[model samples]
Target: MVYTLEVPNTYGYVVLGAGVGSVICNIVLGGPVMKARKQLDVPLPNLYATPGVHKNADEFNRIQRSHQNYMEMLDSYIAMTLLGGLQHPIACAVGTVFYYIGAILYQKGYIDKSLDVDLARYKKGGALKWIGFFTSMYSTCALAYTMITAK
Candidate 1:
């Protein structure tokens, strides 16, 4: 029996695996978790408000639109990750670049006022919160590993 030594292609494999895992996990658990969070009867703080009067119906609708846009951004990001993982090395490179850009933006307070009050209610130190945190952490780690291992 001869064992041939092939250098482990860690980067390619990790990216592909993480991408597939993210798509599956999000599709399976994301909707249900979001729905449950919506059911929580908590009032979210208003991040945006004009000086005098509170937000009118139209303003509230605008805020909802922003949230929808954010969700769409997330969907595209995950899709990109999966596509990169399954495609050429360029995809992995793109994924790595996007990750770093997001990290930098996050560090610079680009996302500070983006949290919704109702969504925060679900993160009140319970099983759901832990699960959410762990899932995010795992995904982050997977992406980081893939980026680091890519040649």
Candidate 2:
């Protein structure tokens, strides 16, 4: 007998939510970058403001790096959330929620003038990030393992 994989019908909603959330996250994080770009006169093709040459360079760099850093891992987050949701919707969804919460906090901590001095402020979000990432990763691995061993 072969074990067949079955995904819940409602999981589709979870996937769609994740997609919408991703777009929202992108916009939320990127908005400041665009504002900083115009304010700082960071022209196209030059991704970041020069540390010494540009006024308010430190702040601009923080904003840019926060957005850039999030984007760097977004694809993985989406993949894990969606794929893992196929078999473990609740876990994936919960993980995604935590991840986004962490992301927002992480961005806030990085850019907050009062908190910027302590780079460790970002660690608070980082912990939540790992919780989410690992949950999805575990789900994905579980799904893969189930599929592979199914006969």
Candidate 2 — which residues are off by over 4 angstroms?
1-3, 116-126
The C-alpha stretches of model 1 lying farther than 4 A from their native spots are 1-70, 89-97, 100-151
lDDT against true structure, model 1: 0.39
Q: All candidates' lDDT scores?
A: 0.39, 0.80
Would you estimate the TM-scores of all the predictions? 0.29, 0.86
lDDT tens per residue, model 2, 57-97: 88888888878877899888788878888899988888887
lDDT for 24 (candidate 1): 51
145 in model 2: Cα distance from truth in Å? 1.3
Residue 42, model 2: Cα distance from true site in angstroms = 2.1
lDDT of 1 by residue, 1-151 (tens): 4333243355464464345544553343334324323443213453333334543433343334333433454554554444444333444444444443332323223222355544432232222323323333455556556666666
Q: List the residue pairs that clash in candidate 2.
A: 2-151
lDDT (Cα, 0-100) at 64 in candidate 1: 41
